[model samples]
Target chain A: MTDLDLSALWVSVQLATTTVLVLLLVGTPLAWWLAHTRSPLRPAVEALVALPIVLPPTVLGFYILIALGPHGPFGQLMQLNLAFTFTGLVIASVFYSMPFVIQPLQGAFEATGTAPLEAAWSLRASQWDAFLTVISPIALRGYISAIVLGFAHTMGEFGVVLMVGGSIPGQTRVLSTTVFEHVEAMEYGQAHALSAVLLIFSFVVLLAVYILNRRFPIHAS
Target chain B: MSRLVAQFDVRYPTFHLHLDLDIPASGITVLFGPSGSGKTTLLRCLAGLERAPHGFMQFGETVWQDETTGRYLPLQTRPIGYVFQEPRLFPHYNVRSNLLYGYNRIRRDMRRIAIDQVVEILGIGPLLERRTHRLSGGEQQRVAIGRALLTSPSLLLLDEPLASLDIQRKQEILPFIHRLHHELAIPVIYVSHAISEILQLADRVVLLKDGSLVGVGTLNEMLTSLQFRGSFGSHRVGAVLDAKIIGHEPQYGLTQLDFSGQRLFVPLQPSAIGESVRVHVLSSDVSLVIGRSHSPTSVLNVLEATVQEIREISQSSVEVLLDIGAPLIAGITRKSLVTLGIKPGDSVFAHIKTVALNEEVTD
Candidate 1:
């Protein structure tokens, strides 16, 4: 493979890894609140989070580009430029992959119910203790699925990253954008090789999830 | 006497509960009621799991909740152990870790119950290393109880702990619960709708119906009270007599019990003489005879009783509450009542066809 291909692959790996880590840290509490809270705003917030799933990637990328530009609210307030940067790409990928990480975690938390937590409370576990000792272990499967889906979804981002990051080599360029560039350049051989790698990687990650999930059923009594 | 005083007035959309209770601080005090009768709600209130906005509860010196003073202790802070109907063991933890979950949380000096003793009492030694998902329903409950006991709480709340178990599983757990009553000094407030469990485990019963406290009394007092019987269904109508084993007739395979001044015979009991046993005699098993009939019969217990009151149960049947030193109820036909001229204050002979000895109870 060419150095550009290696650089694009490395950038893609870094972006996916960072995005998944950020989602896990940020999404856990958000997913937990969505699973438990009965507030009227819960549905509104959930719908908002799930918006990117149905909205076209280009639309999300366009809105994110506007929000992070020097003229937009964030750039105006913070006096920082993020558009056409690696950070902008990461932020866009996180938004595009939001539902993929959150929905599974929310389902897992809801399925656990409050019975075990109440049981833990009666046994002298504080709320925090119960979450650590009881809840986290039970919701481990959700974390696994969230990480796999979130990382895979971020790796496959093309339209959103291209719109925000503009295919800058070794900085903003990633495998999906490079694949597009190769196909546009009529280099079918490079395009085919990159597509095959992505296909195998995605298949292996999904297969591992299904097999592990079946082996350790989440709802075992 | 050490006692728990609880006053709760809760208003929910579907139900309203208002109760005042003074429960003895030791032995098993059963909260008996039908479904949606607020038994479990009362338990939750006592455990501080359900906050009653205008409630007050004090167990001995501990003030769990007093809304007037704006003092309320959350569940984890209260010295209580609760066993829910479902054995809510941590599915991720093995039996040993589940038991230790509470045991390790308390300060070492405040740990009143030894882990080994709890394991022995619940008979969960063999299942300690097993995963919670692998346990049978009965075994899971036993481990739950053991886990609760190891916490060394001042009070234990058990909300229909046996409700989810089958008859055989209930039988498996009942002995362990019985042993817990005898072995521990902690006050247990057991909530159940089952009559047999009340008859077997209750030293005192707090009867509730439709969010109201109907009565609170000893097992014998409640069982014999017509008001209690009326609240319970007709099938559960019975009398509980405290009788002492006086002698054993090995040849006849019978044990003689002395109740008040009357001698009653029962199937051979494992307990020695002088041990008191609670005998549950269903009102339907009692047949009344005027002026002591001198005829050969299969009945073993024939006692002279004074009719305290007679209440018509149905068009055909009447319930006669008799004072045989202790209260004993007999369900007789209205025709027989009229034929024999049985009325209030009339002396009669109560021929008990069967007296089911409640062998599960031990004081």
Candidate 2:
């Protein structure tokens, strides 16, 4: 596939891995708060988290690009170049992949029920400990599915990656953009090879998730 | 030295749970109530799972909650071992790790109960290697108990730990819990709706009915009292007796028990010599006679008992509760009472059938 397309593939992997890790850190607590909090602001917070999923990916990327752009509030406040860079790609991927992980995480949190949490609380496990030890472990199957789906979804992104980061070799160029470049250059054979490789990667990840999840905490059913 | 007092008012979406209770700091305290009667709510409040802005909970030296102060200790920080109705073991860890998850968190030199002892006490040795899902309902609960105990909780909160099991399974798990109550120094708050469970397992029972406190006392005091029957089904209605198993008569298929200087013959049970045993001499099983029956019938158990009180149970039946010193009640037909002139304070011999006796009790 054109000498393994090392730079594009490396950048894509870096972006996907970074995005998943950051989302896991940010989304774990967010999903937990969404699942548990009884505050009146919950619905609004949930809708805001889900906005990236409901709105077109290009729109989300555009807003994020503007917000993180040099003249915008975030960049002006932080004094950092966050648009059309590796960091920007990661940010855009995190937004695009959030609902993928958070939705499944919320489902898992809900499935854990109130009994165990209460049990852990009374057993002297702190809220953090209870969530980490009891709720997280029990809902681990859903969490794994979320991780795989989120990583795969970010890897396959086109519009968000394109908007936040147009083709910039080594710096921002990813597999999705590389394929677009191949198609534009009329390199159908290379495009076909790369597409086949991406299909295999997605299939393996999804299958591993399904098979492992079947034997996960809640059991086969 | 101080007692635990909990008085709480809870407002829910549909129902209100109002309870006033005092649980001492020793023995297994059972919250005996029917479903949706605020038994669990009371437990949660005691455990700090729910904070009603105005509820009051006092435990020994510490004040857990006082609505005016807005003082509350969250459940995780509270030193309480809790077992929910379900096993609720972590799926990621095998039985051993799941147990250690709590144990590892306890501060050094703060370990009151040893790991080996907990594993031995709950008999969770074989389960340590197996995945949580691979374990049976009873096994999972045993591990759950082990996990909770390892935490060295100040109070153990068990919300119907035996409810999920079948009759046979429940029977198997009860003795382990009985040992927990009798052996452990830590107090327990057990919530259950099963009258049979309360009879088998509780030292102190706080009875709840529709979110209101009804009765609180020893099981014996609760069982014979008129208030206790509303919790136990009418068919299951009977008196409980605390008796000392004097010895066994194998040839006669009877076991002899002594209570308040009265020697009573009961059916045989698996018991050690000089050990005490509780017997549920169902009121319905007793046929009272004014004079000691010298009839040579196959009725194996006959004891000289004095009637303490009598309550009308049904049209044809009268519940004659006896003070065999340790206390026993007999459900007899009104015809037997009137025709035989069975009255309170009347000394009589109670004829009990052999097969009616069950062996699973603690006196």
Candidate 3:
């Protein structure tokens, strides 16, 4: 592979890793709240989180680009221009891959129910301790699914990253955008090689998830 | 004696509960009621899982809930060990880790129960290394109980701990519960609808019906009282007698028990001499004769009793509460009552069939 392809692959890996880590931290409390809250707004919040799954990536990226522009609200508050930067790509990937992470985590948390947590509380575990000791272990499968799906989903980003982070070689350019650039330039050989790599990687990640889940089912009891 | 005083008034769309209780803070105090009768709800309130805004609770010196003062302690703050009907063990942890889940949470200085003692008491040592999902219903419950005990709580609330188990599993877990009552200093409040469980474990019985407190008394006082017999259903209507095992008649395969100066024979039990046992004398098993029978009878227990109170149970049956040193009940037909002209203050003989006497360990 050329150096440009290698640089694009590294950028994709970096973007996916950063996006999945941020989603894990941010989506956990959001998913936990979505799983447990009885408020009428819960459905609305859930729908908002899931919007990216149904919306075209370019549509979501377009809005994010506008919001992160120099004169926009977030840009003005942070006093930084985020458009076309690696940070902009990370933010766009986080938004695009949010539902992939949250939906599974929410399902896991909901399935745990309140019984074990209540049992923990009665055993003198504080709310925080109970969450760590009882709730988190039970929801480990969901976390694994969320991380794998979120990372893989971010790695496959094309329209969203292209709209917000225009292809800049060795910087904004990633494997997916690079493949699109190669195919547009009529380089079928490079496109075929990159596509095969992405295909194999996606298949292996998903296969690993299914096999691990089967070996260790989510509901322990 | 120390006591758990509670007053709760809860209102729901389908049920309304209002009751005041002063339970003895020792042994097993059973909250006996039918389903939807608010027994489990009350237990949950005691555990602080359910919050009743108008409720008030004080266990000895600690005020768990006080609506007037607006003081409410959350479930984690209260020193309570709750065994839910389901085992509710952490599926991710093995039996040993599940037991220590609570044990390790408690400060070492505040821990009253050692983990080894609980493992021994529940006989769960062998199952310690096994995952929770691999254990049977009874084994899971034993671990659950061990987990709760290891918390070293001042109070234990068991909400029908055996209700989810089969008869054999129930039998397996019952002795462990009985051991808790006998060996632990922590007071327990057990909720169950089964008369057998109440008779076996209750030191004090609180009867509830339709979300109201029906009666509260010792097992003997409640079982013999004519008022509470209706709630126990006709088949289970019986008196609980506190008796001591005096001798074992190996030749006859019987255990001789003495209660209030009266001797009774039951099937041979494993209890040693001088050990106290609670005997259930079903009212249906006792046949009353107006005057002492002079002829020989197969029934071994025939005692002189006086009719204290008579109540009409049905169109055909009447429940006669008799004072036979200890209280005894007889479900005699109304026809026999009228034919023999038996009334209050009349002397009679209580003939209890030998096979009907069930011996249970006193809590």
Q: Which residue pairs in candidate 2 collide?
A: A121-B75, B277-B363, B278-B362, B278-B363, B283-B331
**Highest-lDDT candidate:** 1
- Fraction of the reference Cα-Cα interface contacts (below 8 Å) that each candidate reproduces: 0.66, 0.58, 0.81
Model 3 scores a TM of 0.91
Query: Over the full model, what C-alpha lDDT does candidate 1 score relative to the true structure?
Result: 0.89
lDDT of 1 at A12: 95
Docking quality of model 2: it rates as acceptable
Tell me how many clashing residue pairs each candidate has.
Answer: 0, 5, 0
Clashes of 2: 5
lDDT comparing candidate 2 with the true structure? 0.80
Q: Tens-digit lDDT track for model 2 on A44-126?
A: 98898788877998898898899889988889999987898998899889889999889888888877767677766666677
lDDT of 3 by residue, B1-363 (tens): 888999999998899889999987888899999899999999998889999979999999889999999999999888889999999999888889899988888888989889888989899889989989989989998999999999898999999999888877887877678777678878899999887788777888999988899999888788777677666665668887768899999999999988888788888988799977777888888998867777888888888899999988889999899998778888899999888798899999899984344333121
Worst 10 residues of 2 chain B by lDDT: B354-363
The residue pairs that clash in candidate 1, if any, are none
**Residue ranges of candidate 3 with Cα displaced over 4 Å:** B272-275, B287-298, B302-307, B310-320, B331-349, B355-363
Range of the 10 consecutive residues with the lowest summed lDDT in candidate 3 chain B? B354-363
Q: Write the per-residue lDDT of candidate 3 for residues A1-221, one digit (tens) a residue.
A: 78999899999999999999999999999999999998999989999999999999989999999999898788999999999999999998989999999999999989988888998898888888999988998998999999999999999999999989999987899999999989999999999998898899899999998999889875556
Candidate 2 per-residue lDDT over residues B82-108, each given as its tens digit:
888888887767888888878888896
Query: What's the lDDT for residue A14 in model 3?
Result: 94
